[model samples]
Each structure stands twice: as structure tokens, then as C-alpha cells.
Target chain A: MRNILILLSFMFILLSCSKEEKEDLPKDPIILPPYNPTYVDLNDRLPSYLPRMDIPADNKTTIEGIELGRALFYEPLLSGDGTQSCGSCHNQSYGFTDNGKKFSTGIDQVEGNRNSMQIINAGLRTSFFWDGRAATLEDQAFGPVTNPIEMHEKWPRAVAKINDISTYREMGYKAFGVVQLDSVLISKAIAQFERSIISGNSKYDRWKKGEYQMTPQEDYGRKLFNKDRDEIRDSLGNVIQVIPGADCFHCHGDLSDFTDNLFHNNGMDEIFTDPGREKVTGNAYDRGKFKVPTLRNIEHTAPYMHDGRFKTLDEVIDHYSDGLVHSATIDPLMKNVDIGGVRLSLSEKAALKAFLLTLSDPDFLDNPDYSEPPPL
Target chain B: MNMNTVSKITAILMLVTSLALTSCSKEEEMGCWPPLDVPGDSANVIMIFNATTNGQPLELLKNFKDPLGRTMQVELLKFYVSNVFVSFNGASTLLKKAALVILVDPNVTDTTKKHNEIALKIPYGNYDRITFSVGLDVVQNAGDPTKYPSAHPLSINQNTYWDAWGKYKFFMIEGKGDWDGDGTLTNIYGYHTGFDECYRSISFEKMLTLDATNSNETLNVNFEVNDVFFGKDTLDMKLHPSWHGDINTIETAFIISDNFQEGLRLN
Candidate 1:
């Protein structure tokens, strides 16, 4: 009986010790305030799934990397003629797309094949360019720099120019651990800065987060956006399901980043014969297809289409409503749908346009970080 | 019974406790449940493609028949097959690792480096049924290329047809076809299909049981190219059917039929 009492006392002591250890475990650290230049407490407000910007294993992002990238992005020395920077085509005031032309002119007044894609919320994009050619923002950065029509500078020369600057040299070394530059390191730094150009503070975003209410017309437009159109038939006279009508979601579907990242021949103009995608594949069937651009800031990034054929959102809507041209390669979903040729009522068009305008993010346009580097 | 006897008993108890603690310390130093030196086994399967017609080895790009039975020269031949899932008694394994590889001049009979194409390492396991598709997944095909390297073949310039569209050529089947009067010159025609609609899924139960033991093994898979074209209903490429570009019509028929299954010969 005395031994049993001793054993029970020892067990009780061990249990108490375990309980104390459990209580002593530390809790997770609380995130501090002043999330950025502003004193906004954003720890609780940020979305959990916001894509973590990819930093190359080789060149990681740092304060110096962002600063150097911003300077290079704004500097004209990146161009072959030393006249245009990436900022020339992607101006902050115009939603990161040039407002002056249908197709932005590059070096020597050479015209690009496609309209300038808007860079608003581009950080969230899974692929860059209408063709989805470049896989990363870094890869896309090298295109305009090297394209004969664009900045027109070879990668080696571009890297050499950046290496010449001591500030950039030091910044590159500090950020990527090398004063000498390469395409990979250059692209990484530029991509890091580009990823920082996030734009989610739109009224639509507010509505999604349940922070704001939509107007009655805007509500109706949203309903139409989700509803399917009437059944349509293809050029071959095959019946096609048209459940979701003028739903932009059919193409530019994702709520946050509007592009679906799929290529389609949306029956813009049948006779143009540009052979948009076919040129890439050499297949007779792939002709006339082009990637659907994002609709996040579609209101500002007009004239639309690969060639900037449509001047206004109304024209684009009209094209979708009643302007569809029958072709062998037209998307099956786009077959004889009453849309692309059907005329929407003026008031309905106005409401739809209003709904599109809600997508414009004021914070992105005014973000100080996205602006030109403050004088040195 | 005296104080000296009590001191000796105390020393024995202390020694026992010290030995128990030392054993435990050694165990801690050895660390976690499983020891570091334990050996684990895995399987690796290599797929080999050889193109042959009848008993003779047929050149993929060079030989083609025209209406008058005339020979035609060809240049390139490539195609895409994705969503490859291997099953052992109806369980899926890592299949996305299978992707497109270009076979330039598949018809060349020279036992040189041209004929050999192999996919990289797949974790070793017993797979009785191996199934693969002729096209990409809808989500994967449509998803932005910026996220992953595998999504965009053009980014690496793996696909030759990278200019007309930014998309990776899902499939490139190029060869010489019979022309009206164009003589012995190589006439290149390619069948490259991609986009969400073009996505095709093919699942087949591999009859051969794969045994992954100590060493890696290669599963020699022989595909008769003609089988893909000659189905229960022979699809004559010369007819130039309107449904060639129509993915919906072709993908449904191709995925369900035994045409793709019969074409696969595993040794």
C-alpha cells in the first residue's frame, strides 16, 4: 500500500510538469503595423491566396533590387536609340498602356503587331503577352528590349550598359550578389519590381470583399454577366450550347485577373487574314486565333483587339453582340450566338460600361511606388 | 542494518539511474524512429518509340504516297500527349511528368542518335495499367504560362512553331504528302493542335505488370503510327475532313475508341 502511494505521487508530479510545459509554448508572432509607405494595418486585410511573387533562386528580391529595376524601367538608355523606356509604352497615368496610338510605335517608329497590353494587376498574370509566349515577367521584359521593333537592344549590350553604372552595380551585387550583369539577373530584378505593381483596390474588389454595395444598374449588369445566352449553332450548322451569354467570364473568367489565358478567334474581322496564331504553328487550322486580353482595366486599355480595331468598349460589345463573322476556325463557344451581332439597348450598354469602369483601381493608378523614380 | 549498509544501497540506486539515463541519451543521439541507413526501392520506366510499317522500318518524314502512288519527301514530325496516368489495378500515379517530345525525321532507319527519345525519371513503383492522352488538360492548356515552365514550350524554344502564336505547339505531325504535280521535293505539312477545345484524354490499362526491384527498368513501348490513322473506320488523311480543326468532335471520338489503345505495343 505504501509503494502504491509513492507511485501515484510520482505520476501526479510528471503530469503536472507536462501541463506546465504545454502552457510555456510560445504563440505565433503578431504582424506589426505600417505595412508600407502608408500606416495601413493590412495584416488581416490581405488575401491569403495572393500569388507570392516568384523570385528566381539565383537573384532574390531586396530593397536595392526594386530601386534598381525602377530606375532601369524609367531610363531611356535601355532602348537602342536611347529615346524610349518600358515606361514609354507603359505609362502610369494611362493604366500602364500608351493612350496615343492603336499600336504603340517602338524604336525608329516601327509598329508592333499587337496593341500594348495593360499592366494593371499584371503581377497576378500567369503568362505574359497575347500569345502567352513568355512564361514569366522576367522573360517578357527581355522581349521588348530585344525585339527589332521595340527597344531594339541586344541583351548583352543592355546588360553591359547597366553594369557601367556604379549605383546599379552596387545595387545588383547587394540584391543578387554580383556587380557584373546577365539576362537572368536583369530579368529577375525587373520582374521583382513588376510583381510589386499589384492593383486590387478597385470598387469591384471592394464589392467582392463585401466592403461596398453595387448600384442597381451595376447589379443587373452583373446578373447578365453570369447568365448564359440563347443556344447558338456553328458555321457547319451544328448546334452549340449558349447557356452563358455575353458572360465575359466565358473568356476573361477569373474574378481577380480577368484573362482566361486561352487563345481564341473571337470573329473580330474575318477578312483581315492576319493569321494571328497560325503563323506560330504553321498549321492551316490555327490561323486567325489570338489570345484574349485581360478585362481588368478594359475601359482604359482601348482600342481593343490584337490590332486595336475597336476604339471603344461599346464597339467591342457591339462586335461581340452582332459583329461575329462565320469562319472554319471560330471558337465553338462563339458559334451563331445571338451575341456578337445582337444590339444591346443603349441604357443596357451604358450600365455594362459602368460595370466595366468599376474595375479601374484608383490605388494602382496613384500608387507612388509605380510612379517614375523621384528625381534621383 | 547499519549506516554503512544504507550508504551502499544508495550508491547502487544512483548507478542504476545513471545507466538508464545514458542509454536514453544514446537513443536520442541516434535520433527519430527510423534509422538513417535503411534502404528504399523505387521504379523507373523508359518509353521508346520505333516507327515501322508491315515488317519493314518506315521513315516518318521522307515516305508518303500520293494519288498516283508516287513518293513524297517530308521534313518534320512532332505531336503532343499529356495527362499520362499509370495505374496498378486502377490507381493513378505521377502522369503529368510525361510531355511532348519532337521526333524529327522519324523515318530515318540509321541506328544513330536520331531514333532515341526518353522521358526523365519517374518514381519507381509497380504499375500494371499505364494510360496516357493525345492532348493537354483543359485547365493546363488554358492556364497562364507564366506560372510554370512546363506550360510554355515556346519560352524554351523547344517547339519550332513558336512565331504564329505564343502557345507551345501541342502536336506537330509534319511529313511529305502527295501533291498534284510537285515532284520528289519535300513538301512539309504540319498538324499542330492546341487550345482548350483541342484537349484530348486517353486512358488505357497496360496489360504487362511492371516489377520495380533494386535496379531501374525500361518499358519498351512500340507505337504503330499507322494505327492512329487507320481505326475501325479508317481516317484517310487524304480526304481532308472538315473536322480536322474541330477539337470537340475529334477529342470525344479519339478518347473513347480502341484506336489509341491498340496502337500501344509494350514490350
Candidate 2:
């Protein structure tokens, strides 16, 4: 009996010590260092490097949400006819832009009023749409899906279709903790995927990061592009200070994206037919004015202007250089100044074009992450 | 069983007693404070804008008060006042909580149908002082349109203004007035406005005390439009000149700053 009691006590001590040891064990184990490249490998590359996306506190990004958004972006179920998707107009090969079309084709072969704006680096834009109708990318996503001529589907119907899909239903639940979906969640998901489509690995970015060097002509063009335009007064009567001389930055400022978020009547046309901004505002001074387009991937987003009138960069530069027409609502900066229009020399224009080309990131266009997903 | 065992047991008992005593004392200390619940009998004040002349409600377009106090027919009365601060029992607590502020247009079809109402949900408490601005602050007026739902409609109003257009209309008053040349067919504008520099701040602190039980109560504050043109600075409704913004005439500014406040009568 004594030996048996001693044996039992020994067994209890051993068991308790082992249990405590197990409880105290570290959770994570050290592993070998991950393979990192010293230089960016042109071949077999990873995803594009995106700048920090400014997400609202209300909307947070998740992998599952982005995945669901990607599916919705490519899925034709979002359209009434089940034929058109966001990817239809935003083809990846053409830098997520419908090539050189005067206007993008929507559902039932219906055409939109303006050309499809390129989605390259669209995440960096402060506002969306040529008229600056939508304030955020999420709001922009809500536009085409509900437009009668575009997707031709109500938000509820589109969300119902997404909810019907088992994969999306699961994804929705995982991301937002609810299988039921709404326009807010739908827009949030699409915005997440769009925010992930950042295009920062361009030649210009590489040069800026000291990874690559710009050619002499390209360097000259960069100087002219960044050249401060003459000081111009905004529609609000505040004097806008610009550097260099052309004051292009007055509308397109120096930032990650070049738009200043200001509406202007840039003297695009003499006639006041469209009355672009005046349609929104009953004010007489806003007639024929429109928001300025960003110049990040301006080389790819051709057929420029609110109406998509100009086809080539040369034509666009020429218009800015000489084709400025005067009007009652013309921007005061363009009034009575010989240099109101762009007056770049031939070499300067060529250099500018070269510099603009540097804005194009081959890595962004070829990013597999932004491409179609593998066969599900 | 042994001396050491007795000492160990006594020490353990004392430790347990000390822990219990400490916990009880801590609980007593925590329990000594009372919970803060704002009383519900706080007066719910609603400002009612009414057109009146000499303490009598004026008709829509007739019997309006002129600069000379003569009974003259007038058309429009619009002006903007900004930087409003409300005080509770003469104490400054207007900005303490997020107050629900709305612009209720009595002339709007739906608003008029709904008794010409805009409601802001304020915390339940005693407030003797109610202050508000006629115009928006520069930050509120110039914030990102997507941030605020109230500002969204005006920013994206297809028939009004675009999101990029950084101007907000505080008050728009339009009607036909007697012209210098011809007759009553002429359009006179009494656009009272506040934007940027034209922002005016109005504050009112009343000595009245309110007692609110556990139920909701309302205080109806009335504004006389005729009294807005009274005092040393008078507004000529027939001439209906533009005041505030770019066309800030001295008479308009004085009318906006002084006479408008004189018309406020809180009941």
C-alpha cells in the first residue's frame, strides 16, 4: 500500500509537469528567411506596388471582399442582359480602357456619351467621371451599374444576383459577416478591387525611386510638364498660384494624381451648347465648364476632352497651344494673354510626348493579379 | 498537524481575508458614484419663420412692412446669417454633442406638406439658450460632398450645382417687386446670403429655466419677418437689393447683422 501510494504521487507530479510544459510552449516557430530580390525582376514579377489607399473608416478592405469584387467585375450577371461587365469596357490589354472608341458600348449595344476613361492608377484619383459627378471610386462604381443605358439593372436586382451565387454568397458572408448584400457592400467590394489595381511601377516611378534613369529628351519633357503655368484665378475668384508658366498645374496639380478637383471653363469651344457644369448649377458663370482630366496615363486615354474630340496627344497639345476659344465664361487666366494657349516648340512637344510615355507602366498592364482569374 | 502547518494555514486564511476585504472595499469605492443620465424634460425648441407686420401675421404678398412702416406690398425676403452657437442655461454646451441640423424650407412642396419641418435630434437636457448660424462654416460648406448626406443633395443636385462647384446657397428669396422704370412685373431679388467672409454668427441666451420630467417637451420659437426690416437698419422690400456674398451693401450687412436678430422672439 505504501509503495502504491508513492507510485501514484510520482505519476501525478509527472503528468502535471508535462501538462504545464505543453501549456508554456511557444506558438510560432522560426523559419528560414524568405527569398527577396535585390532588384525588380522584369520576368516572373509579383503584383504592382500600390501607394497607401485612403480607405474611409466606415469601409475597410479584406481579401475576401476584393475577391468577390473581382468576380463581380468580370461576371456578366451584373448587366440586365447578362452580356456586359465592367471588364467589357475596361479591357486589361488596352490599359483597362476601351480602345479609341468615340464612346463605349453598353448593354443592348447602347452607346454612352463620353469615352471610357482608363482605369490605370484610378485609385489615386480624388474624383471620378469626366463631369466629376461621382465623388469617390465607390460612388463611381454605383454609376454604370445603375445607368439605364449602361448596365440597365437596378442595384437591388444586381445585388440579388450576386447573393444567388453560392461562391459570392460565401465570400460576402466571410467579408461582411452577412450573406445578404446591398448597394453599399457591392460598391465597397468593387472599390476594394479597384483600389488594389494601383499602377505605381511605371518607368517614371522607377526613375523617381532612383531605380531607373530617364533619357535626355524624357527629362526635358518632364521639366516642361512640371513647368508652372502663369497664376490663374479659379471660378471661386481665388488666385491660384502656379510655377513655370503654362500653369497646367492650376487644374492638374502636382500630386500622386494630377487633378486639382476644380471645375473650369477651359475655353474648349466657343459655343455654349453643352453647358457642361451649368447643367448641374443654374448659375450663368458655370456654362461650358468641365472638370479637368488627370494626366497620369494621358497617353493611353486618347480621344481627349469632355466630348472626346481630339484623337492624339499632338492634337491635344496643339489645342492647348493655340485652339483656345474665348467666351463670356472663359477662365480669367486665359483672358488677354498670348501664352494662354500652349506654345511649346516642336522639340518641346516631342519631349513632352516622350515624358508622357514614361507614365505608362508595362508592369501594370501585364499584372496577372489584375488579369482574369484562373478557371474557377 | 505541526507548528509549521498551523502557521501556513493561518497565513493562507489571513491572505484570503485580506483579498476579500480589498475586493469589498474596491466594490464599495466603485459603487459610491451615481450614474449620469441626462434628464428627458429638456425643452425641444423649433424655430418658426412667419411673415408679420406690427405683431400681426402678414399675408403672402400683401400688407408687408416697408422702410417707412407704411403698409406696402412686398415680394421676397431672403438673407443669410452664420456661426450659430446654442447655450444651455447660459452655459456654452452647443458644440458638446453632435447636433442634428437641417434647413427646412417652408415653401418646398414636400416640406410644406409635412408642416414645413426640419428636425435635429438633440440630447435631452435643459437648454435656455438656442443659437444657430444662417450660413454654413467654410469647412462645412467646403468639405468633401460625399462625407455628409445633407450636403450631398445640394452638391450633386442635377438642377442645382455640381460636386466640384464649391458654393452653397444659404437662402434664396425671389419674387416680383415694384421696379424703378415700369410696374410690378419686374423681378426683385432679396438673396440673403452667407458664404466665406459674409458668414454672420448669432447667439441668444435667455434667463429662462426649463424643467423636464421623464417625458419629451417642445419649445416653439417664432420669428417676425416684418421686424427683420425694423430698427435703425431697415430693409426696403420693394427695392429688394442683394445682401451678402459679393454684393454685400452696407445697408444689407446691417440688416443681416442687427434687424434679423431683433425679429427673433422665443416662446
Q: Candidate 1: misplaced stretches above 4 Å?
A: A1-46, A49-55, A153-164, A180-184, A232-244, A337-348, B1-267
Q: Chain B alone, model 2: TM-score?
A: 0.57
**Backbone collision tally, model 2:** 18
TM-score of each: 0.55, 0.50
Top candidate on lDDT is 1
User: Could you give candidate 1's fraction of true interface contacts?
Assistant: 0.00
DockQ of each: 0.02, 0.02
Give the per-residue lDDT of model 1 (tens digit) for B140-252. Answer: 45433333342233222133222213334455444444444555332223344555444545554564443454335555656555554464445444332112233334442
